[model samples]
Target: MLLDELVVTADAVASTRSRLAKVDALAELLRRLEPDEIAPAIGFLVGKPRQGRVGVGWRSVGAAMGQPADAATVTVAELDAMLDRLAATSGAGSAGGRSHELRELTARATEREQGFIARVLLGEMRTGALEGVLTDAIARAADRPGPVVRRAATLSGDLGETARLALTATEAELEAVGLVVGRPVLPMLAATASSAAAALETTGEASVEYKLDGARIQAHRVGDDVRIFTRNLADVTHRLPEVVEVVRGLPVHDVILDGETLSLDEDGVPRPFQETMSRFGADAARATLLHPWFFDVLHVDGRDLLDEPLATRLAELERIAAAYRIPGEVTTDPEVAERVSREALAAGQEGVVVKAIGSTYAAGRRGSSWIKVKPVHTYDLVVLACEWGSGRRTGWLSNLHLGALDPTGEFGEPGGYVMVGKTFKGLTDALLKWQTEYFPQIEQRRTENTVWVEPTTVVEIAIDGVQASTRYPGGIALRFARVKRYRDDKRPEEADTIQTLRGLLRM
Candidate 1:
C-alpha cells in the first residue's frame, strides 16, 4: 500500500460519478487486504489516518497540495511531505534523514509508513464513499455477514478495519466486537427527564436513575495513569487536570466511566453550551472551566460491564464516587433528578439523560435502548428521497426528500414510505452521493430524479410548530422536517406515522 496506490484509489473513487460503481470498485480493492491492512487502506483512500475521528477539510488538503485557490485538486507530494514529517518524528530523525526513511519504505514496498505519515499530517482522509456504504461493500466483497462487518466496525471504531478483515477472516479474529456494540452513547442532550415512565417503558426496566449533566465525557482509565476522553474519544485528560485529580483520587483504580463534565458559575449554576464546548481540547485553561459528575461505570477492575445492565453499573459508580467524594454527585430519586436537570437547564445545560438500572451500554446505536424524551415534539425521520439541492447544494444532491412510513400500505403502495418534503442541511457531498445511489433502490419514481425510498432511515426532526396539511400523504406534514442525522440503527418500520404526525398537530 504505497502512497501511489492510495492516490490511485482516491482518484478512482472521487472521479467516479456512479455511486454503485464507486462502491463496487472500493469493495474489490478493499477485499484483497489482510485484517491488519484495512486501516491503512482506508487512510490511503481518504489520504489520512483512520484512527482519529477528525475530518480533513479541503482547505488543509489544498495547503498540502499547494493548490491555493483550487478546492478539489489533491496531489501525492503534499501527501508525501506529510509522510516525511511523520517519519521525522515517529520514524527517523530530521528532515534529511526522514526522506531517506521514506525512500526505504518505498524500496521495501510498504504503504504503512507512507499512510501513517500522511495521516499524521493530513488529519483526515476524504473519499466520496461513506462508512456505512463502505461497510456494505466490504460485506459483499468479503462474503461475510453485514452484522459481522458492523460489529467489527464498532469495536475497532474504524470501518477500514472492517473492510480489511472482510478480505480474509478467521473464527478467532484480531479484535472482539462485543464491547463496542452495546456501549452507551448519548442519544441527544435532553432538556429533562420529564417522567420515570419514559425511562422505564422505553428501556423496559425498573428503577431508572437520572444523571445530571455538565459536559458529556467517556473517561477511560488504563492503570495508575488516567486518561479522560471526550464524547468523540479525543483524550483531553491533560486539559482537565482537576478532573484527572478527581479520577485519580477515586477508590476504583481501573475502569471506564461515562459521565458529564460541568463548569459551574459563581452562582453554582451550569454555564452555557457554547461555553462548555469551548473548554474542549483546552489543556491549560481547563482548570478554570470544568468538573466531573460520574453517573455510571461501564468497566472496572478486570471485568467488562458492556454486557452488564445499566442499573448494576450505576450502583458501583455511586459507591466509588461516594468513597472518593472528589467532585462527587449521584442520585436515584426522580424528584431530585428533575431538580438537577431543571437546574442544568436554568444554567444553560441541554438536559438530563435518564438510564434504566438494567440497561446495557449500546454504543453507536440508538432507539429505545436509551430513550430521549424532550419537552418538544420531535420525530426521527429518514431521507427517503432527495431533489438536487440548491445554492450550496449546486451540483450535489442538494435537497433531501423526507418521508415517514407508508404504514397503511396506502394508494396501492404498502410496506414502503413516501416523500413529504426535502431538506438541505446536515449533509456533506459524500452523504449526497450516498443518497443519489441508494435512495433510488427503494425509490418509487413518479417523476425524473425526484425519487422515493422505502423510508428505511430515521432522522431527529424538530419544528418551531406543526402544521395541518391533508394533501400531503402523511395527512399532516411537518412545517420544517430537517434532518438531524441519518441514524443507521433505526429501520424504516420505526418511522413516524400519519397518526403520530396528526397527534402532534392536534396537540
Candidate 2:
C-alpha cells in the first residue's frame, strides 16, 4: 500500500477523541493492509519504524528536509526497507551517509508524508490510539474476542507480529501463542489504590506483597541457560549475571519468574532507588550486586501457569522458589493486610501490592486484579515557563516547567525558585488555551519552542513522591508529577519549599 494511505489513516486516528472512532479508523486501516504490509503498517501507525530508532534524531530529520513530490508513490515496504538500510549504516562518516540517505528518502515524500515520517521518527504520533487501542482495533478487524487478542499480543510482547497474525492466521493459531521457557513475556502490571484497606476491600482475599521501588525483571530459564528482560521486554542478560546466577540456583529445570531486582547495602537493606537504577543501568563490570526478589511464577517445570489463578501460581512459586519470594501474607482480613503494609513501609520499602487471589495474570495491562497502595504528596508549585504543543495540542502551551520556591538564595536569587521537573498532564483543551493566553501576559522571555514567564503562577501539583536526583539544582525531583489545578487562592510566597519536598526522600 502507498505510504500516503497510512499517513492519512494516522491523521484520521489523531483527529478524533472518541475511542470507538479511533478503533474503527484503525480497524479499517488494518483491513486494507496486504499480508506483507501488515507488520510495517502497524509499526508506522504506532509512530515507530520497523528498524527501531534508526539513529535518526530531530536534527537529522530536520536537516534532511526537501521539496515534496506531487503524488503518492512510496510504498510502505519501500519505506521499511529504506529504514532498515539507515539502521545498518555505521562506522566513521556514517552520520553523513545516513543524512544523505534520509534526504533522498525525504525528497521523494510529499509535504504531508514528510511530516508523517518526521512524527514517526520523533516518536510523537500523538494519535489517541496506542497499543491498547490498536489491540481492540485488531480484534475488530479479525472478528476475534478482545481478550483473546490482548492475551496473545501480551504474551507475544509484539503488537506488530500480533497484527500480522490477526490479519493472516486463524483464531486457533493465535490462541496457540503461549508462554515460552526462554522467551520473555510481558510482565503483569498493577493499578494504584488510595490505601491498602481499600484495595483489600476490592479484592477480598488478596495477597499483599511488598512492592519494591526497584527495576522490574522477568527471568526466563531453561535448564542451565537463563535470560532476563526488563518490563519493556529488552534483554539485559549480560548486565544481570548475578540475577541469572540466582535463578540458576533455583531447583526448577525450566521456569519463568516475574520479580524485582535492586541493589542492597551490606546489611541486606535495600539502597535508595536511584542508587539501584545507577547500578542497574551499568554494564556487568559494576561492583554493586543486584539482588532479585521473586513474586510470581508464570511457568514452572513443564507447567504453564499464566491461565492459572493467582493463588495457584503463588503456591507453585512457594514450592519452587520460596526463599526468593518477596515478603507478604495471604488473607481476607484488612487489618492483617494493613499490618503487612505498615511493616513493609517501616522496613524502608516503597509500599504493598494488594492482589486478587482468583484473578489470572493479565500481562502487559493494568487491571483491577492487582492494586498498589503508595503514599501521594501534593504541593503548591510555580510554573516557570511553558513549551509550545504539538499534534492535537498544537497552538497551545502544553508542557509546563515546574519549580519549587527556594527561600535561601542557595541555588538562585534569595527568593527565586528552582525547577523540579516539567509536566503536560491533566490539561484539558480549555486549560491549554488558558495557559497559552495567560502565560504570555507575564512573559519574562521567549524562545522558539518555549515562553518564559514570571514564576508567580502557583499551581497545585500531585506526585507519587519526591526522590533524590542530580538532574535539578534542588538535588531532588518529583516522581509522576501532574498538575491538579491552578492555585488561585495561593501566592508564590506560600508555595511549598524545596526543603519540604526533599523530606519525602526519608519516607
Candidate 3:
C-alpha cells in the first residue's frame, strides 16, 4: 500500500472525536493492507514504530527535511525497510549515515507523507487511533469477535502479530494464542480510589496488598533459566541478576510471577524510586541490590493461573514464593482494610491495592476488580512544555506545563494531551538542571521563554484536587500541583486522563 494512503487514514482518524468513526476509518485502512504491511502500517498509525527508537531526534528530522515529491510513491514496505536501515545505523560515522538515509527516505515522500514521517520519527503522532480503538478496528476488518482478537493480542503481547493472525489465519489458530512461559504478557492495571474503605467497597472480600513505590517486574522462570521484564515488556534479565537468582530459587520448575523490585536502605526501608531505576538502566549491576516482592503468580509448573481467581493465584504464590510475597491481608471488613493501608504507609510504602478475591486476572485492563488507594492524590501526567526559570534559578527549565491524556478527545484532540496546569514546585536543583539539558533534546518547537516538547515524559504529580476552570482547555485545572517524581517506567499513553481529572471535581 502507498504510504500516503495510510497517512490519509491517520489524518481521518485524528480529525474526529467519535471513536466509532475513527475505528471505522482505521478498519477500512486495515482491510486494504497486505499481510506483510499490516504491522508496519499499524505502527505508523499508533506512533510507535516497530523498529523502536531509530536514533532519530527532532533535530535529525529537521536537518533531513527537503523538497517533497510531487506525488506519493513510497510504499509501506519501503518505509519499513528504511526504518530498519535507520535502526541499524550505529558506529563511528553512523550519525551521518542515518542522516543520509532519513534524507533519502524523506526525499521520496510527498508533502503530507513527509509530515507523517516526521511525526512518526518524533513519536508525536496525535491521531486518535489508540491501541484499544485499533484493536477493535482489527476485529472489524477481520470479521472476528472483538473478545477473541483482544484475548489473542493480550496473551501474545503483540498487537501486530494478533492483527496478522486475525486477518490471515483461521479463528482456531488465533484462539490458540496462549500465554507462553517465556514471553511476557501485559501486566494487569488498577483503578484509583480515595481510601481503603472506598476501594473495599469496589472490591469485596479483597486482598489488600501494600502498593510499593517500586518498578514493576514480571519474571518468567523455566528451571534454572529465568528472564525478567519491565512493565513495558522490555527484557532486563542481565541488569537484574539478583531478581533472576531469586526467581531461580523458587520451588517450582516453571513459573510466571508479577511483582515489584526496589532497593532498600539499611533500615529495610525502600530507597527512592530513582535510585532503584538507576539499577535497571545501568550497563552493570549496581552495588545496591533490588529485592523482588512477588504479589501474584500467573503460571506454575504448566498450569495457567491467569484464568484462576485471585484467591487461587494467591494460594499458588504462597506455596511457591511465600518468602518473597508482598505483605497483605485477606479481609472484607472496611476497618481491616484501613488498618492495612495505615500499616503500608507506616512502612514507607505507597498505599494499598484492594484486589477482589474472586476476580480473575484481567491483563492490560484497569477494571474495578483492583483499586489502588493512596492517602494523597497523585497522578502520572505528561510534560507538554517547559519554561525558562528566572531570578536565582535563571537559565534553567523550571516551570513545567503539564497535560493529561485525552484518548477519546472528550475535551480536546483525540489521542492528544489536555493541558491541566503548570508547576515549578517540588523540583530540586538537580531536577532543574536535568530538565534544562534534556528538554532541548526532545524539543518540538520553542518560544522565547517556553520549549514545547513532545508529550512523552511521564511525571508523577501530587495535587490537592482539581477544580472547574476556563484557564485551560480541559475545563479543569490542577489545584496545588507539584512534581512528586519522574516516572521513567511509564509511557505518555499511560498517563492519567482528562476525564479522570474531571472526575475529581465530583469529589
Candidate 4:
C-alpha cells in the first residue's frame, strides 16, 4: 500500500542468496502488501496500462505509487519531496484520500513532463536495478531455496501474470490460470492432426488446410475499429492502412484474423522476404509490391474461435471471409500443401505453415498445433578484433572480425588469429538505410584505411564448406562463408560463442 513496503521487500531480497533468508524476506514483504497492492503489482508486471491490443512500454513506479504524472515533470528534489509526501500521508491516516489526491495532481501537471514520465513508468526510481533483478530479489526475500522464483516463473505462463496471481489468489487459483486445467486468458491452440486417414485414427474426422508461406500477422477487430499487430505484439497498424481498411469493410461486427502479408511480382507470385519488409518501415517507399493474404479467421460476429476445434472454425471462417469475398486469403486442400509450398518457395516465398482441421487460435504463444517449418541455417565462429567501416560505421567500429575458437588455446580477446573471410553483406537495403542514418549514435572513431569499431555486431554465414587457411586464425577458414544477415535480435555475448566455434570446427 505504501512505497516503503515495496522498497523494503526489494532491499531485503537484494541482500541475500541464502534459502531460509529469502523465504523469511518474502513473508515479511507479504505482510506489507495489504491485498490492494495487487492491482499496481499486476500493472507493473504487464509493463503498461489496462490490457490492450498492442501495449505501451512500462510506466514509472512514482506514478503507480500515486504520484501525479505531472509530479514527474518537477525537479528530482521536487519528485523526492512528492514521494516523501505520499509516504508520510500513508503513515498519517487516509490512504484512499492520498490516492485520490495524487490522481487529481497528475491531471493538473505540466504537459512537458518527459523525464518524470519516463522515470515513473520505467521504475527508473532505483539505479543499478532491473525487473529481473527485483523479481529475483522477491524470491530471495521469500526465504525460498535456489531459483524458487525462476521455478515459479516457468510454471506460470509468464512472470508478470504469475506474480499478479500469486499476490491475489490461492495456489489453486494460480493453477487455474495455467494451461493444464485453466481457461487461458489469451488464445487456445488445436492439437496437430495427421493426414485425413491419420486424422480418422486420432479424431475420427480431422480438419486440415493447405499450408501457407507468409509473414504471420494477427488482426484484432473490435466493433468498427480494427488493429493489426505482429506475432511479437508490436502494432503495425500504420504500415498497413490498406489492410486495416480491407478488414474493416468485412461484414463481421467484431473479430480476430490470423494470416500473413506478402508481395507479389508481375506474374502474380509472392515476392522475396527482403522486398516485403521494405514496405513497413518509416522510410519505406510506396509498397505496391506487398499485399495481404488472409488465411484463417480467429473470431467472428460475437464469437471467439479459441477453444473450438479447427474443423468448426474453418467452416465459420469460410462463411465470413467468403461473405466479404476477401481477396488475399486462399483456402485449399491439405493433401496439396507440399506442392503449394514448393510453388511458393519457387516464387521466392518462405515455407508454409500447416494447420489442422480442428485447430484453435493460439494468442501470445508459439503453439505446437500451428507449426512454422522454415528452412533455417546456422554457423559457429570465434571472435577477432573488428574492422571499422565508413559513413555510419565511421565511429564505434561496426564491422566484425570472425575466427574459430581454439580448443587448446581458445579465444581470449585477440588470442587466436584467423582470416577466413570478410563480409559487408546480409543486410537488406532497408537495413543499410537505417545503419547509414543511425550509425553516428554508436561510432567511436575513424582511420585513413582501417576503421576501429565497438565489436557488437554478429552474423551467420551460409557457405559451401570449410577449408584450411594460412592467413586466418584457428588454422582453418570458412571456404565461402558470406554474410547471411545481421542478427539484430541477439546480443554480442550471445553471438556464436567461442565454445560454439569449436563444435563447428569439430564437424
Candidate 5:
C-alpha cells in the first residue's frame, strides 16, 4: 500500500474525538493491507516503526531533511525494510552510513510522507489510538473477540506479531499462543484506593499482601536458564547475577514468577524508591543487592495458572516459593485489612495490595480485581503555568506546572512559588475547557507552547509522597502527583509551604 494512504488514515484518526470512529477507520484501513504488510501497516497506524527505537534521535532526522518527491512512491514494505537497515547500522562508520541511508529514504518521499516518516521515527505519532485502540481495531478487522486478541497480544508481548496472526490465522491458532516459559508476559496491574477497608469492600475475603517500594520483575525459569524481565519487558538477566542464582535455587524446574526486588538497609528495612530505581537500572557496581519477594506464580511445571483463580495460584506460589513470599494474611474483615496496611507502613514498606481471592489475573489491563491501598498526602498548591494539549485534548491547556509556596523567598521573592513538577493527569475534558477559558484571565505571559499565569490559583493536589531531587529549588518533588480539585476557597498565602513538602521527604 502507498505510504500516503496510511498517513491520510492516521491524520483522519487524529482528527476525531470519538474512539468508536477511530476504531472503525483503523479497521477499514487494516482490511486493505496485504498479509505481508499487516505488521508494518499496524505499526505505522499506531505511531511506531516496526523496528522499535532504532537509535534515531531528532538530530539525525533533522539533518536528513531534503526536497520532497513530487509523487507518492514509497511502499509500506519498502519503508519497513529501510527502518530494518537503519536499526542494524551501528559502530565505526555507522553514523555516516545511517545518515546516508536516512537521506536516501527521506528523499524518495513527498512532503507529507517525509513528515509522517519523521513522526513515526521520532515516536510522536500523536493519534489518540495507541496499543489499546489498535488492538480493538485488529480484533474488529479479524472478526475475533477483543478479549481473545488482547490476551494473545499481552501474552505474546508483541502486538504487531499478534495483529499479523489475528488477520491471517484462525481463532484456534490465536488461542494457542499461551504463556511460554521464556517469554515475558505483561504483568497484571492494580488500581489505587485510599485505604485498605475501602479496597477490601471491593473484593471481599481478599488476600492483602505487603506492597513494597521496589522495581517490578517477572522471572521466567526453564531449569538452569533463568531470564528476568522488567515492567516494560526489558530483559535484565545479565545485570543481576544474584537474582538469577536465587531463581536457580527454587525447587521448581520451570516457573514464571511475578514479584518485586529491592535493596535493603543494614537494618533490613526497605530503601527509598529512588534508591531502589537508581540501582535497578544502574551498572552492576554497587555492593548492595536487591532481594526478591514473590507474590504470584503464573506458571508452574508446564501448567499455565494464568486462567486459574488467585486463590489457586497463591496456594501454588506458597507451596513452591514459601521462603521468598511477600508477608501478608488472607482476611474478610476490613479492620484486619486496615491493620495489615498499618503494619506494612510501620515496617517501612509502601502499603498493602488487596486482591480478590477468586479473581484470575488480567494481564494487560489495570483491572479492578486488585487494589493498591496507600496513604495519600493532599495539599493546596499554586499553578505556575499551563501548556497546550494534544491528541483528544488538542485545543485545551492540558499540562499544569505545579509549584509550592516559598514563604521566605528562599527560592523566589517573598511568598512566591517554586516549580516542583508538571502533570497532565486527572484532567477531564470539562476541566480542560474551564482551564482554557479561565487561566488566561490570570495570564502573566504567553509562550508558543505554554501560557504563564499568576501564582494566585490554588489547586488541591494528591501525592503518593515526596522524593529528594535537585531539579527543583525546594530540593524535592512530588511523586505520582495528580490534581484532586481546584481550591477556589483558598488564597496563595494559605497554600502549603515548600517546607511542608520537604518535610514529607523525612517521613
Candidate 6:
C-alpha cells in the first residue's frame, strides 16, 4: 500500500474528537494493508517505527528535508526498508551515511508524507491514534473479538505481531498466544488514591503492600537463565547481576516475578530514587548492588498465575519467594490499612498499594483493583515546553510547562496533553544543566523564550493540591507545584490525565 493512504488515515484520525470515528478510519486503513506491511504500517500510525529509535534526531531530520515529490509513490515496504537501513547505520562514518539515506527517502516522499516521516523519526506523532484505539481498529479490521485480540496483544507484548495474527492467522492460532516464560508481559498498573483508607474502600479485603521508591522490574527465570526487563520492556539483565543472582536462588525452575529493585544504604533503608536509577541504568553492575523484592508471582513451575486471583498469586509468591516478598499484610479494616500506610512511610518507603484480594491480574490496565496511596500529592506529568531561564539561572531551561493527558478530549484534543501549569521549583543546578543541554535536542519548535518539545518526557511533580483556574485549558492549576523527579521509567501516554486533575477539584 502507498504511504499516503496511511498518512491520510492518520490525519483523519487526528482531526476528529469522536473515538468511534477515529477507530473506523484506522480500521479502514488497516484492512487495506498487505500481511507483510501490517506491522510497519501500524508502527507509523502510532509514531513508533518498528526499527525502534533510529539514531536520527530533529536536527538530522531537518537537514535531510528537501523538495518533496509532487506525487506519492513510496510504498509501505519501501519505507520500512529505509528505516531498517537508518537503524543499522552506526560506526565511525555512520552519520554521513544516515544523512544520505534520509535525504534519499525524503526525496521520494510527498510533502504530507515527508512531514509524517519526520514526526515518526522524531517520535512526535500526536495523531490521537493511541494504542487502545488502534487495538480496537485492528480487531474491527480482522473481524475478531476485541477481548481476544486484546488478550493476545497483552500476553505477547507486541501489538504488531498480534495484528498480524488476528488478520492473517486462524482464531485458534491467535488464541494460542499466552504468557511465555522468557518474554516480558506488560506489568499490572495501579490507580491513585488519596489515602490508604480511601484505597481500601476501592479494593476490599486487600493486600496492602509497601510501595517502594524504586525501579519497576519483571524478572523471568528458566532453569538458571534469568532476564530482567524494565517497565518499558527494555532488557537490563546485564546491568543488574545481583538481581539475577537473587532470582536464580529461588527454588522454582521456571518463574515470572513482578517486583521492584532499589539500592539500599547500610541500614537497609532505600537510597534516593536518583541514585537507584543511576545504578539501574549503568552499562554493567556497579558496586552499589540493587536488591529485588518480589511482590507478585505471575508464573511458577509452568503454572500461569495471571488468571489466578491476587490471593492465590500471593500464596504462590509466599511459597516460592517469601524471603524476598515485599512487606505487607492482608486486611479489610480501614484502621489497619492506615497503620500499614504509616508503617511504610516510617520505613522510608513510598507508601502502600492496596490490591483487591479477589481480583485477577489485569496487565497494562489501571483498574480499580489496585490503588496506590502516597503521603504527598504527586503525579506523573508530561513536559510540553520549557522556558529559558533568567537571573541567576540564565541560559538554562528553568521553567517547565507541564501538561496532563486528555484522553477523551474533555478539556482539549483527544490523546493530546492539556497544559495545566508551569514550575521552576525543585530543580538542582545539575538538573538545570542537564535540561539546558537535553531539551534542545528534542525541540519541535521554539519561540524566543520557550522551546516546545514532543510530549514524551514524564516528570513526577508534587503539589499542595490543585485549584480551579481559567488560565489553563484544563480549568485547573497546580498549587505550589514542584518537581519530585523525572520519571524516566514511564512514557508520555502513561502520564496522569486531565480528568484526574479535574477530579481533584472535589477534594
- For candidate 5, lDDT tens digit of each residue in 7-75? 888888887978899999999989899998998887877666668877788999999989999999899
lDDT for model 5 = 0.89
lDDT of 6 at 157: 82
Regions more than 4 Å wrong, model 6? 378-507
Question: Which parts of model 4 have CA positions greater than 4 angstroms off?
Answer: 1-166, 169-215, 272-275, 281-290, 322-337, 378-382, 385-507
Lowest lDDT block of 10, candidate 4 = 48-57
Shift of residue 28 alpha carbon in model 4, Å: 9.9
TM-score of 1: 0.57
Which RMSD values do the candidates have, in order? 13.1, 1.9, 12.2, 14.9, 2.4, 12.1
lDDT (C-alpha, whole model) for all candidates: 0.56, 0.89, 0.91, 0.48, 0.89, 0.91
The candidate that achieves the highest TM-score relative to the unseen native structure: 2
**Pick by TM-score: 1 or 5, better one:** 5
Compared with the true structure, the alpha-carbon lDDT of candidate 6 equals: 0.91
Q: Using Cα atoms with residue i matched to residue i, what is each candidate's TM-score against the true structure?
A: 0.57, 0.95, 0.77, 0.45, 0.92, 0.76
Superior by lDDT: candidate 3 or candidate 5: 3
Q: What digit string (tens of lDDT, one per residue) describes model 2 on residues 167-208?
A: 899999999887778877778889989889999989989999
Model 2 regions more than 4 Å off: 67-71
Q: Write the per-residue lDDT of candidate 4 for residues 1-507, one digit (tens) a residue.
A: 434344444445444545455556655555455454543433332333122211113432244343234333333233334444554553444555445544554454444343333434443332223344435544443333324444444433355555555555555554454232111123333343323233334332333333333455667677667787665455777788777887787777777776667666788765544456667543444846456666666567766566687767767767767543223222344445545555544555444445545555554434555543334436644333345544233333335456543334554444343345555545554654555455444556645644333455455666544434455544455544556666677655555543444343333
If ranked by TM-score, best first, what sequence of candidates would result? Answer: 2, 5, 3, 6, 1, 4
- Candidate 1: misplaced stretches above 4 Å? 1-26, 33-37, 44-48, 51-130, 145-149, 161-169, 175-200, 206-214, 285-287, 323-348, 375-423, 426-507
| Residue 40, model 4, lDDT | 46
Worst 10 residues of 2 by lDDT: 44-53
Model 5 TM-score is 0.92
**Residue range 276-317, candidate 6, lDDT tens digits:** 888999996478989999899899998999999999999999
- The local lDDT score (0 to 100) that residue 260 gets in candidate 3 is 97
